[model samples]
Target: MTAYLTVVEAAEHLNTSVRFVRRLVAERRIAFHKVGAHVRIAVVDLDAFVQAGRVEAITDDRVRRDLSGAA
Candidate 1:
């Protein structure tokens, strides 16, 4: 069975604030369901959203190399 999560749970899982999660939902950037007055996110949807925004962390050396010629 698929699991559903509350806004706070989703934010914790995303390592972001609840406001940002709500903004994503409000902007239609992520999918969610409204149950009465509460918003619920599907685990799969949250995973997909996270994957879509995934970025690799850059080391100091990499940053210097990338910005070598920048003024």
Candidate 2:
């Protein structure tokens, strides 16, 4: 069976604040479920959310070799 987490748990797992999670729910940005007036977020959904927001930084490191403040 898949695991489901509460708003608090979701926030903790994401290392963010509950307000942020609540805001996402309010903004309809995150997948969630309603169970008897309680909110639940699937673990997969949380993982997906994180993966979706992942960013890869690409930088060229061959143009910087300044070890002194003399230009």
Most accurate candidate by lDDT: 1
Query: After superposition, which runs of candidate 2 have C-alpha atoms over 4 Å from their true positions?
Result: 59-71
lDDT of model 2 at position 21:
98
Q: In angstroms, how far off is 30's CA in candidate 2? A: 0.5
If scored against the real structure, what TM-score would every candidate get? 0.72, 0.80
lDDT of each: 0.93, 0.90
Query: Can you write out model 1's per-residue Cα lDDT over 1-71, one digit (the tens) per residue?
Result: 98999999999988999999999999999999999999999989999998998999999888898889653
TM-score of 1: 0.72
Indicate which candidate wins on TM-score.
Answer: 2
lDDT of 2 by residue, 1-71 (tens): 99999999999999999999999999989999999999999999999999999986644442342344334
**Would you give me the overall lDDT of model 2?**
0.90
Kindly report the root-mean-square deviation of model 1 from the true structure over all alpha carbons: 4.4
